[model samples]
Target: MRRVLALAACASATVYFEETFDSGIGERWQTSEWKDPMGAWVWTSGEWYTNEAKAKGMQASEDMRFHAISAKLDAPASTVDKELVVQFTVKHEKKDYAFCGGGYIKLLPGEVDPKAFGGDTPYAIMFGPDLCGYDISRIHVIFENKGENLLKSDEIKLDYSDKDEFTHLYTLHLKPDGSYEVFFDQKSKASGKLEDDWAFPSKEIKDPAISKPSDWVDTKRIPDPAAVKPEGYDDIPAEIPDPEAEQPEDWDAEEDGEWEPPMIDNPDYKGEWKAPMIDNPDYKGEWVHPMIPNADYAPDTYAKYPDLTTLGFELWTVNAGSIFDNILVTDDKAYADKMAADTWAIIKEGEKEAKDAWKKANKDDDDDDDADVDDDEEEEEEEELKDEL
Candidate 1:
């Protein structure tokens, strides 16, 4: 029993990686080889008023192009554990609104060349928030298994409220039991089994051998044999001359065409008959296809990447102004929660206060400009009056 207990202790979770960006990105993080002529990633002291607090962080160059950056692990970390968690904070501080960009990170295999990374590079896992025009605002959770990269089939909706501008934490938890959960600002926004959410072959498929018979009485209604059409039903004309219509008295029948009143719909006319439906006595309920084991389907152990070597942010943005910081990749959930509470919870309040203050100052500046414009218009009016005199 003591030997088993010792083995269980050895398998517990540990914090294998972290990056707070307090000190510079250092030599560990490397920029990708794929470069956009228009833009690049830069390290700065945050954006807006938040810059005053944070000494160093990474953000896009605010140009309309792509940006890719990566950081490799000292050694590959094994993902064969029961649970794996990744957490990071991102701030979309584009004052005029963000158009399109990806705030996600990718977990690449050990064999990848950090310098040659691009969008086409293969990754073991890809997860985070992605935004486009008004329609698309979602958290993407993609996993690679057996050479096929499968995106989560179900929609992962995100809160696109006013709070999006502030720095918010995004967390993804993957378990060996084939379950996953996504958290926003440390709150669970979405959770589901991996197999059910991903676009993989169904574990059970309809039995192809069985099918509905040709003579199956699926219809609920039949023509009534006792009921007969009314006596004058066929004789009744669809249209008749209007009773209130009158012919013109000046009509000349010899030279001009004959004058007639416009036809009106016959009130007695009835539409085509349809038999009234009753409960279907011979109905075999709705025909359901019997499910059979899918020959090609295999259960995912959720341990696809036993060795995770590199983590990177390889994405494209149209109007770039997003800051990414405090990335943590660990097998321990407790450690991740603690880090978020300590770092994110503390600084978020200050960031919000500063953002609000900046907005108020801009409003005041605009009001003053309007006053100046009004005064100039009044002076021009006085000059026009003098010229008229």
Candidate 2:
């Protein structure tokens, strides 16, 4: 592909973080002993449907538990006038996966005690998909500012991938131009100016001096004074007996009693009537508040994060079995693309096939189980019949 070619062309871009979880989990990663302890992470391919050994990923091993882990980079990378790209893959493989948790990874600022990292620890950016029921299924892009975290204003809905339980890719590209692009499974999901999308303080505010005039009539329409309800409008009933009704010939007065015809919708009926509406003569158009330069808003280099020393995941999940793998934090988009193609794209089809095969195997087993149960029931019935005889 052209992306692979581009990657070869620009082979000089720096790679800040890369983890496949092949090994060195203890050597490279730090599991937090933060106040509530931490959930265990097992290197696994999940219970069903996998690409064999290739499917091995970092899986959250416990349900209803907190997980906090981080790995230190050999050299911390900074995003000063440089492009920063972060990408990772997640597989929610649990059959009954009901997520009330976070899978978003954090890019920790500078060097700090990795074990002490918790919910309170400051992070440069938190990015990934977070799902809780149907209402909240979105890839959160939150950034920290002055010890306070600011969540993105724009909602980046889920990619709505066909295979919800299969492994999917999430890629975030933060460029130097104050813009960002988020990709789901190599497909562009959301792209925009970071300033416009994130909860940054507005550059301008409503003019404090100006207020709406008291005489301004905002009501665009009003009931017409001349229009009136019909004199007998309220007197009409909604339904009446059919006028053409005749008693059935089979009906006997003593046996069937008096039979009445079913009521039909009344054609002459008129419901509660209101005066007709007309455009108000004194109506004024909707007023927009004039904006003035905000005195409080002072622009800064918000895009730059000088110290991105550690890559971490601090999460809490009700149903475990979310596998994370193929993480890459690099400056080169081309390289990241190539890496994704090499890892996710190639193995995805095989994974689906494997999943189907697993499902078929399980179904066959269930059928066998049902057959056994039927046989046992049949024997019991035969024994009962013999005793009766």
Candidate 3:
């Protein structure tokens, strides 16, 4: 154990891993065999124009299905530290802006076959955003403890509405105290205890033998027994003839059956009789399930991943147009925060400005094209008149 601690201390002293994709994916990154004939991983200077600058990034899919890519750290790092931090940025720029793709990454352990990586491949941690149709649009933070992969039990609602079409930064931090924090664009979004958030069976559960008494009055209100229906209430008809409606002066009684007044909804008619309700004096409060020590439940001491080796991105996308960049994995919170501030903060503001400029340029081009079409139409009409003359 002494030697192990010494080795881990040496490994954690230096920067664990980082990627910026400025010069394109080099020899370190490897991609899986293309599942579809048209599927591809594209490296572009910028997917969209934002002010005058373009975002140079890597896109994992090409509007195709079953796309997968992985970037294994040249020097695999250990996650067996007092704290672990992971951060990355993603941009979804699909033409229609409605796409089903993964913005998350997977951190793998031990040696992994980069050529054959897929969804079933086991990973130490999986964190990022995922969207599918209308229902699934959330950031997923899953941790592999023991032999089981446990997902956070709480639903994380991400902002993926139609108007949301910009780059977003995601960060995850795991502490030795068995707590975790999730951040979006440097803002703390969610945090909780690992044991409480994950789908681990509770150490304490509701007592099966305990139940509320049969006579317990849970209803808050009760019908008044003394309240009675008013006199002649039932005599009021649901409909009555309109006395104000005038009949035609022509004697059409024999031609059109009997001259009867048209029936209309009666103003005085009440639909039904019901007793008034009042607060019940015997009403009891809400019943809470009594919990006791679960005989089958056993607490888990969160294990450290001292052998964490590889990190990768394995995904399946339907309308692929997600750009991933600026990946960082380390045990240093200060380093992670600094990287976010230096990279994301600078690029985010520029990206927004470039996006607006691009929209204006495209609109102007469209307007010019429309004017040329109108001029051609006028020339064609003049030519037809000359030929007639």
The candidate scoring highest on TM-score is 1
Residues 73-104 of candidate 1 have per-residue lDDT tens digits of: 55465556457788888877762332677889
State the RMSD for candidate 2. 9.2
- Model 2: which ten-residue window has the lowest total lDDT? 1-10
Best model number under lDDT: 2
Q: Please give, for residues 196-226, the per-residue lDDT of candidate 2 as tens digits.
A: 8776666899999999988889999999999
Residue-pair clashes, model 1 = 0
Tens-digit lDDT track for model 3 on 1-389? 00111233233433456777767766677778745452577776454544222255667666656666776654556655457788888877662323567778888888888887877888888999877644567888887876799887886767534224577889988887778889888778789887788866678988999898888788999898789999998999999999788887985888987888889999998899888999988898888889998765533355356666677777776767777777887777777777677667766776656665655565666587785676578557545643553
Instruction: After superposing candidate 1 on the true structure, give the runs of residues whose Cα lies further than 4 Å from its correct spot.
Output: 1-13, 35-38, 50-55, 95-98, 208-217, 222-231, 242-263, 275-285, 359-389
- How high is the lDDT of residue 112 in model 3? 85
Q: Which stretches of candidate 2 lie over 4 Å from their true place?
A: 1-9, 35-37, 48-53, 95-101, 133-135, 159-163, 223-278, 296-300, 358-389
RMSD of each: 9.4, 9.2, 9.6
Candidate-wise lDDT, in order: 0.72, 0.77, 0.71
Cα TM-score of candidate 1? 0.79
lDDT of 1: 0.72
